[model samples]
Target chain A: MNFFGIPDIYLVILGLLFLSIIMAIIRVIKGPTAPDRIVGLDTINTIVIVSMIIFGLAAGSVIYVDVAIVYAFLSFISTLFIAKYLEGGEF
Target chain B: MLNQLIDIVIYILLAIGVFFNILAGIGLLRFPDVYTRLHAGTKCTTFGSIFLCGSVILYGLRMWILGNVDGSIWVIHTGIALVAILLTNPTGAHALARAAHRSGVKPVGAVIDELENKPTKKSANKMEAKK
Candidate 1:
């Protein structure tokens, strides 16, 4: 089956990903401690990267997957820096 | 016939990946403490991304064999992305766990606190500064 010329399965998978993202967002908002929020943020980043790849495939474009690669590295760096800041020690 | 079989395999991979990704989200919400939540968030997503990216790579490979040059690019780049995810996810989780512990987010209901008694470098440094 297809919707608007895109395969329906792709749309279903994307919707599920969105649901997971929303769940992570809830955790970020409700988390009591700083680390809890950071964990939620990390989950969100990974999910977004996966969805970006799926979107790239569905759209028949290589650029999105390339962007996802760049995003993966940047997010990893950010997560590390945030952890360092929370540790309250010299970098 | 072979093309249809490949399509089926791709679908299965996508399904498995999405299920695990959703599980990660549920785990994040349900787990009580930061450590447990990180366990859920980091590991599940990493596993899920593996399958998800694997499916994409497989699709690209099929396309490349079918005379599409872009498929080769897709496969190579997706493989790199998967590697980046695999390398970085666990490292980031380790950092987050260490930071959480150092920042005093203790695990819930723990009997033995081995690391608690141990003097970390940060504390040793503080002692030096005070002298």
Candidate 2:
């Protein structure tokens, strides 16, 4: 028996996560400055990774978690690159 | 009775995680400046993700204890992913904050500008040339 008496628990969590993503997207689109957009994007990348994990649990597929792990590293790299670009640093 | 207790604890963790995530989203939209927005967006989501993944780890642990062989691997892998998140999230936020500051996104309604008063690389070079 599930805790909340719900058949599929992860699905509900996924819905909320999506709503959060939408809110973040609003910030990204309406952001007045470059750093604002960058912040939004960084937040989105994180939420996306979490959602990937939840989706893996929902689907009962182990591969999805693996994908999430890879995605996390890639996103981290991208964030660093974007930050470097923002700072006008060489290389 | 024991199983129900575990379930309740997991549910609580999940709820807390989701609530903080929602707050992060709202803060991103409502905060007035880039710095405040970053403050809200980064910390809350990182905190929320910890709980969310912790709940999953609990579930995996429960499954393993129930004698599912695959549960062990699942738990280990999920733990690895959680560790990755814990390691990466804060570093990214620090980088973003530094970049935002260096790129000249000032905090809103600020009084003093300490970093601004300090000489930048270019200005320092000019100072050296004049010496």
Docking quality (DockQ) of candidate 2: 0.74
RMSD of each: 1.5, 3.1
The alpha-carbon RMSD over the true interface for every model, in angstroms, is: 0.6, 1.0
Q: TM-score (chain A) of candidate 1?
A: 0.93
Which residue pairs collide, candidate 1?
A: none
lDDT at position B36, candidate 2 = 89
Q: Per-model C-alpha lDDT, please?
A: 0.94, 0.87
Where is model 2 more than 4 Å wrong at Cα? A1-7, B129-131
Q: What is the C-alpha lDDT profile of model 1 across B1-131, one tens digit per residue?
A: 99999999999999999999999999999988998998899889999999999999999999999998888998999999999999999999999999999999889987787888888897888899999
DockQ of each: 0.92, 0.74
